[model samples]
Target: MTANRRPVIVGVDGSPAGLGAVRWAADEAVRHGKPLRITHALGVPGPFEQPFEQVVDEHDIALDAATEARGWYPGLHITTSTWHGSPAHVLVEESRHASLVVVGSRRTGGFRSLLVGSVGLQLAARAYCPVLIVHNAERWAAPESPLPRQPIVVGFDGSAHSDFAVGLAFSEAATRGVELVAVRAWREQARRWGRGADLTRLAAAVRDALAADLEPWQAKYPTVPVGLRAVRGTAAPVLLAEGSDALMVVLGPRGRGGLDDVRLGSVTQQVLDHASIPVLIAQHA
Candidate 1:
């Protein structure tokens, strides 16, 4: 991303969630001194019998909303576009070279207020740069008041997807100039608890591997402060604690679990459900 040209991209469709995203994104562009590129993704229900412009009525409204919100950031460089495709696809593809991507959370069903939507999951899974899944509008509008507190942190397991998440976290820390933390969650069932000696060796191995994975990043961004820890707990609690006061959390979408959810990385999903801050997931590429 060029220092003078790269813009912050946002996805919108005029939902309350989308409005929250626009409002948050406007501030982000100003904070970073980056242009805001607002995009609206639309779709056609049937055959393409009419012009592309006729189907995406939502984009017009989104454009209007973005225009009106620009008042909050009078100096921000803003642009708008309308695309026709999956929200995840359109937004993620557009963010390929973006400094950062921001989007709002979808409402959870009934009382499932903490739930995340399939599109948010898909974007987080696929986006290469930092993606902030804005869930709480009231909180984010005043982001600078008190944020970027590191807690409930998580670390990658060295797969490509996890590496992408690492890069995401690294960029976030670099941007904020805060400590980028790394965590490896551990769980030992009764079957393995008996071998106390073996446990010691296993713990050592996890430690060694984590150091190796973080080496390249540490060296590349030497000035970016870092903290490394291997926790003996489940993914949810560890992540929640690590991500506390976190501006954004990063995770990966692994596979389907016993339940019917399309995205099976429940740890990340659960974090999204409960956390007040933003969550970004990197799915298998």
Candidate 2:
């Protein structure tokens, strides 16, 4: 791997989800023509002291993941590293120099009800680079033949954070030669003085605002076809449904309606927790 080029990093922990992340990351590295870096975290010691053999077993796990990735992309440049720290910390640090960090929606958990794993949640909120969470790699597996281009969905709320998300989404769509769908979801508030007509007018205003916000990005990526969707509903459900067939869903850490004190916005949290497709959280450059 070249020293200057930023590799796409993926965390592996020998779980089914970890394998899914590996496959998705390998495809991304190939699509972007970048190097692939597979990482496994040998977490800090806790109450239970691990035997020497167990530590060696961890190394074996990482090695197996690297081997599997190589099988998928024989010509791609692949590198593997093991970090001695928490998975979240190690991956977050790796994100500092990575073009993108791809991970599974959830890892091995005792409870089957756990939707998104803790490591994924931490990285979504704190990663330095864009974090891509692949929920179902099997459904998103790379096709052997060239398939029709899928659109990239971006949840736009006309906020500063959405600005970054728009930029990233446009770039990805342009690179992949795919369509970009910029969505803005709104909800009508009950008014004491007005009737149902007032709510309809408000919805129209939100739609117009969404179109205006997306105009600049459309102009910037003229080669990339753009689709503007403004609907009356919650942002999370709208984005989730739109992203069902998209290549990936892009969102900001916060939206226009996000609380200032919260690290992760409500819309982002909901999508990250429930979206079945890959979700990309766009952070500041």
Number of the predicted model whose lDDT against the real structure is largest: 2
**Cα deviation in Å at residue 225, candidate 1?**
1.9
Cα lDDT for residue 28, candidate 2 = 76
| lDDT (CA) per prediction | 0.67, 0.80
Residue-by-residue lDDT tens digits, candidate 1, 1-285? 574577878877655666667776776677677889888766432354766676566558567756756766777778888765667777778877787777887555222221236666667656656667877644443324344455324457676556777876776677666777787776655575454446666667877888898999888889887777777778778878877776667775542132324444667768777877777655432
User: What C-alpha lDDT does candidate 1 achieve relative to the native structure?
Assistant: 0.67
Give TM per candidate.
0.70, 0.84
Q: Name the lDDT value of residue 5 in candidate 1.
A: 72
Best by TM-score: 2
Candidate 1 regions with alpha-carbon error over 4 angstroms: 1-6, 23-34, 42-60, 83-100, 109-116, 125-130, 142-154, 188-205, 255-266, 283-285
**Per-residue lDDT for 203-245 in model 2, tens only?**
7797788888888888888898888787778889999998889
Give residue 214's error in model 1 in angstroms.
1.4
List CA RMSD, all candidates.
Answer: 5.4, 3.6
